[model samples]
Target: MKKILLGFIIMLSTLAYSQNELATSYAEKGRTLVMEKKYQEAVESFDKAIAINPKSALVFHHRGLAKANLKDDSGAILDYNVSIKLDDTDFEVFYNRGVSKYYLKDIESAIKDFDKSISLKSDFANSYLFRGYSYIELQKYSEAVKDLDKGLQLNPKSGSGYINRAIAHIMIGKNKEALDDADKSILYNPDDIRGYNIRGQAKAILEDYKSALEDFTEVINKKPDDAKAFFNRMAVRLNLEDKQGACSDYKMLKNLGEKPNSEMEEYCK
Candidate 1:
């Protein structure tokens, strides 16, 4: 009877280990799918892993990432919540949860998660950058600037970071700093058109109409249907005494399916 009981216990232990090994295999397969950008497949593999090992916090976290990449931010948040409940120590889990929340427009909740992430790992640049974005959405420009400043210091080559910082500067009436950031944004992200638009805005605010007009024209040349660039160019032309060009833009607005604004009507007439 003693020998039989000992054999039973060993069998149970071997079965438990086997289950754990199977769960680990599934989890590894999910990670490989994620690296290949096969998010849907990764989620399926993670689902199997979770079924086999429901207590794994890391598996839940990885599943959350797959869901987020699928653009199912709500689903990602659900997974992240479970992961956090299981183990609240991983800084990356909080940061990714914040990102998912931010995408869902839960700005305040996202900031709290970002704060937690920063407290856990202070040197992570993306945490500050995303928190700055949330602050911008909340209209807290000063807080946005402070966060963006830290993020940029941590990663000076981040073009989107510079772009957002420029916007924050513009909101806070720092035109020169905004222009500098816009320039840096362009240098870093040359294929993007946003920097030209923002730079033109700064130049216009500084009353450098000619330079602003050139930037706006460049934008229009790249994106002919861009309403903001077209309108800006029209306004700048008027300031430059090019009445015909301004009137032409006013007429072209109709072709772009846009109604002329009050300013356009007043100036065009």
Candidate 2:
């Protein structure tokens, strides 16, 4: 009887080991599919892994990533919630869930998740960057500046971080600081139109109409159909006492399906 019991125990252990191996294989396949951008297929592979091992937090996390890539923010959040319940120690899971929440416009919840992620991994620059964006959306400019500044300190090459910081500075009426950040952003990514736009706005705020006009004109040269750039340039032109130039920009703005401001309407006519 003892020998028979030992044989049965060994058989059960072997079966469990095999099951775990199969689940791991499926999970690896899912990761490969995700890298290939085959998000739907990746989800199916993760599903098979989960079916074999429902306790696998890693599988659930991978499924959440696949869902996020497919733009299924709600579905991703669901899978991320399950993953977190299974294993709350992974900072990446919280960060990914925060991103999904951000896409869904659940800004407050996203900030909480980002806060948790930062708590788990204090050096995580992206968490700070995204949290700063959330603060900006909430119009907490000072808080946004603090987070963005920290993120940039961690990663000085981040153009998006500089751009966001510039925006926060602009909101607080610190146009000189905004101009500096915009210049840094443009230096990092010359093709980014927002950098030029922010710089122009900052210059305009400082009453540097000539430089502001040049910046706006540069934006128009890069993107000919940009109505906002035309409008900005028009305002600068009016400041420079160039009525003809302002009137031409006003016409272009209308052609781009954007209504001119009342001031522009009265002045241009």
Candidate 3:
């Protein structure tokens, strides 16, 4: 009986040690997978960590990120809620949860989360950026511009901020300001395809077909597989009465399995 009790204690000690080792290993692996953008795998690793240490708030937060990356916004929100319940001090959790809520179209809840995140960490540029985007979606252009300006002030190198701000400007009928912002965005990140796309859109709106065509051409060069770019270039060609060019772009769009609009059929045919 004594020998059995001793063996049982030894086994318990080994099991405890193994559990600790597994928690550490899983935590590390989860972090690595998150860095690699393999969010599903990261969630699995984080789940193992949480199983080993059920009280770990950080594990919940990590798993929340993985869920969010995989578009499981509801699951992500639940994880974030648990994490916040365990520990409300982590500002990043609120911010990330807000992003998930935004995608879920719970704008009010998302705004509240962003507000809480900003309250916890005032200088968070990304939090401000996302908040600004939410405001834009809610049709609050003035507020959107304010937060976007703050984000740009915090991180001037973020080309996306400029592009987003430009969109807000355009929505508010400040077309010239929008153009200026887009130009600056391109200056900040010359290779940003979105910047070119936005500039092309702005040029199209302005009826600058020549410049718009050039911008669309550049987009096609950057992304040959994009049917939208081909379709857009076709429109510009039609406007310019370049029938052959329009037909060629129309064929390309059709070959890429894109549904050409009636205008495309009328002009190209």
lDDT of 1 by residue, 194-213 (tens): 88999999999999999999
Q: lDDT order of candidates, best first?
A: 2, 1, 3
Highest lDDT model number: 2
Q: Which ten residues in a row have the lowest lDDT in candidate 1?
A: 259-268
- For 135-203, candidate 2 gives per-residue lDDT tens digits of 999999999999999999998988999999999999999999999999999999888989999999999
lDDT of 1 at 82: 96
Q: Which of 1 and 2 is ahead in lDDT?
A: 2
> Going through the candidates in order, what is the number of backbone clashes in each?
0, 0, 0
| lDDT at position 262, candidate 3 | 84
lDDT of 3: 0.90
Best by TM-score: 1
Instruction: Flag regions of model 2 displaced more than 4 Å.
Output: 1-8, 260-266
Count clashing pairs, candidate 1. Answer: 0
The per-model lDDT (C-alpha) reads 0.93, 0.95, 0.90
